[model samples]
Target: MDEHPEPGHDPAVGALDPRAELSEFLRTRRARLKPEDVGLRSFGRYRRVPGLRREELAQLAGVSAAYYTRLEQGNGRHVSAEVLDAIARALRLSDAEHAHLTHLAKPKQHKKKPAVRTQQVSGPLRTLLDTMDGVPASIVGRRSDILAWNRMAAAVFGNWAELPAQEQNWVRLVFLRPEYRDLFADWERKANDVVCQLRLDAGSHPHDPQLSALVGELSVKSEDFRRLWATRDVTVKCNGVQRLHHPLVGELDLRVESFHLADDHEQMLLTSHAEPGSPSAEALRLLASWGTDATTAGAGTPPTRTA
Candidate 1:
């Protein structure tokens, strides 16, 4: 046994029970839908259960009530793909959500001992980060870890390179750190996005002990995280505009873009760029020029004199 486990791998975090996860995911999805939302007539009848009843969902998905009930109970053994698709349609799940559903219903076989390797940034990838001068770019691992970043990223975002390895996760930063809450103009949106991404990861890697630990820590520390996690919403924000409030720069509206590495799908290259000739672009240039000094100033620390 590797005495020193990976940073996110806490023995006490406890492995996630996939069956329980599936049940909760199904329950939450079903709870969010109403009878009329799926074109079913409610007839103003008093309803005990929120959203669509199991029987109603079964009818919409063209499955038997008992069958849907069994699947929802986390017993997805021998479930057909077509039936899963029908259920997803009935739930009106997004593409990401549908994928999550599939993963939950038919998880891959787990090894007796799950791998606990630490993720690393390839040298070429590091060089690539350095070459992206104006664009703030970072390489994020599958577990949302900040594996590597460029100077521009440190200048525009916080100085991630200076932080301890374990603290370099997106979910932890968004939920556990007050600074991040202040950094995003719309903190709630950012929180939702991070949680949704985590949800997607959860469905795919239900047996990941590190992920289970991260979820456990976040759920205990953040009421908002607990609320968002319970929603079971899943999404991957590939392209979007993020509003930010930087300490040095007044305000910035940057276009965020993410691309999965061709060779390693588990790693994603995320970059943010401002529109050409925009004030945000000018701010980025200033930060780039100042570089480490700007990072120092951003932290409200006076530059040291070295004569």
Candidate 2:
């Protein structure tokens, strides 16, 4: 008998469960559709299940019912791209959803774990953060780890230098930290977006141990994280607005922008700023002044973690 398990078989306890992910994605997508929504006439008969039947969906997508069933059952080893695309079209998946479907269907090639858990920020990137004196900015690694941050970023967001390196994860802060939860005006919306972004990241880097651990940790600790994760939503972080209740600066609105570093695609530069001459901008100025004073006062002093 072959010693190795099947291609999509669940490996060790902490490894990525690709088959389970595929199964969940297909099932959730299937459950969200109705007969009428896809132009199929409902005969006013009582339906035993929600959404379109598997056979019905298979017919619409021009695939064999048995094949579609296997796909949903997590046996879709080496599933063709053409078939995935056809099914995506049938389901009317959005651009993000379509990309996510592709990711779920095709797992990344297995690789050895890296010795270093975190990627380092480049010197030029560090200089850029320093140059942007007023704007709050930080460099984030692929796994949502805060690689580095400027004084303004440390002032606006919590102090990254104070947190233990492993604990400086954006997703962890949002879900696990009470102060962060209270900082966002639209906490629910922010939470959903962060979880969705992490889902997208997981799809892209399935074999990443650090990513898996973070997901496992959040899943175990937060019911809200687990529920949001199950929805299988995917979003590429680009631009957004953050309404923050800063402890020292009062309420301020900041525009959040994320830029993928050309030198290193796996890392991104994230910044938040307010419109010039706006009240929020003035608040940011005050924040800058306070940050400067705080830095001078604490010069040569070690950073302390904020509660």
Candidate 3:
């Protein structure tokens, strides 16, 4: 027998139990719906259940009440794609939420042992980042690790290079770093979006210990994170506007875009841009100038005299 077990053989990995996740997801989704929301009649009789009853959901989804109950109890076996789709429709899941449901319901079968998670930045990708002089850009890994960044990104989001590798997480910076928290004009909304994104990631990668640990730590430390996580929201990153309060340059309203790497689905390239001739564009120009001056000053400074 091999003395050392595989990486994901730990108790925590086993404890993740995707069946339980599926059950919880279904329950939460069902709880959020009301009778009228789904075109069902609600009598004046006081109901004990918070949301739609199991029978009601079953009827709506065109499934047997017993089967739906078993599914909700985590006893569902060989559930069909048709059934899953019906349930998703019954729950009125958004695209992101529906995807999360599919992930939890039918996890990928690993024919071989899972490879170790890595965040390697390709040479070509690094070269591409260097070419983006004015646009703020960063490459983020599966767990929101800041893999690499351009100079403009460093200027806008603070230099991730100065922080320890383990501290390069987006979730950690959002909740723990005061400067990062204050940077967003819509802090609460942004925080909720981030948590939702993390939840979606968790559903897809249930056995990822690093992700689990990050969630556990944040739950213990941040009340806001805990509250938002309980909502079981899921959202895919998309183009949006980010209103920032830059320390040196004042206000900046930049358009944010997230692109998934074609070679690595787990990696994302995020970039921010401002409309040409706008105040935000001018602020970006000023920021670039300041960064250039700082670089020049540092290069010209004399080396410290060491003992």
Which is the leading candidate under TM-score? 1
Runs of candidate 1 with Cα error greater than 4 angstroms are 1-13, 298-307
Q: How many residue pairs clash in each candidate?
A: 0, 0, 0
Q: Flag regions of model 2 displaced more than 4 Å.
A: 1-12, 43-45, 111-118, 292-307
Q: Higher lDDT: candidate 1 or 3?
A: 1
Q: Alpha-carbon error at 138 in model 3, in Å?
A: 0.8
Candidate 2 per-residue lDDT over residues 161-218, each given as its tens digit: 7789888988899888888887788888888888888878878777777777777767
Overall lDDT per candidate, in order of appearance: 0.84, 0.79, 0.81
In candidate 3, stretches whose alpha carbon ends up further than 4 angstroms from where it belongs are 1-15, 111-113, 292-307
Assess candidate 3 and give its TM-score to the true structure.
Answer: 0.88
lDDT tens digits, residues 141-179, model 1? 866999999989987778886788889999999988898
The candidates, ranked best first by TM-score, are 1, 3, 2
lDDT of model 2 at position 128:
93
Predicted candidate 3 versus true structure: per-residue lDDT over 81-148, tens digit per residue: 89999999999999899999888888777887467577799999999998999999999887678899
Query: Candidate 2, which ten residues in sequence have the lowest lDDT sum?
Result: 1-10
lDDT of 3: 0.81
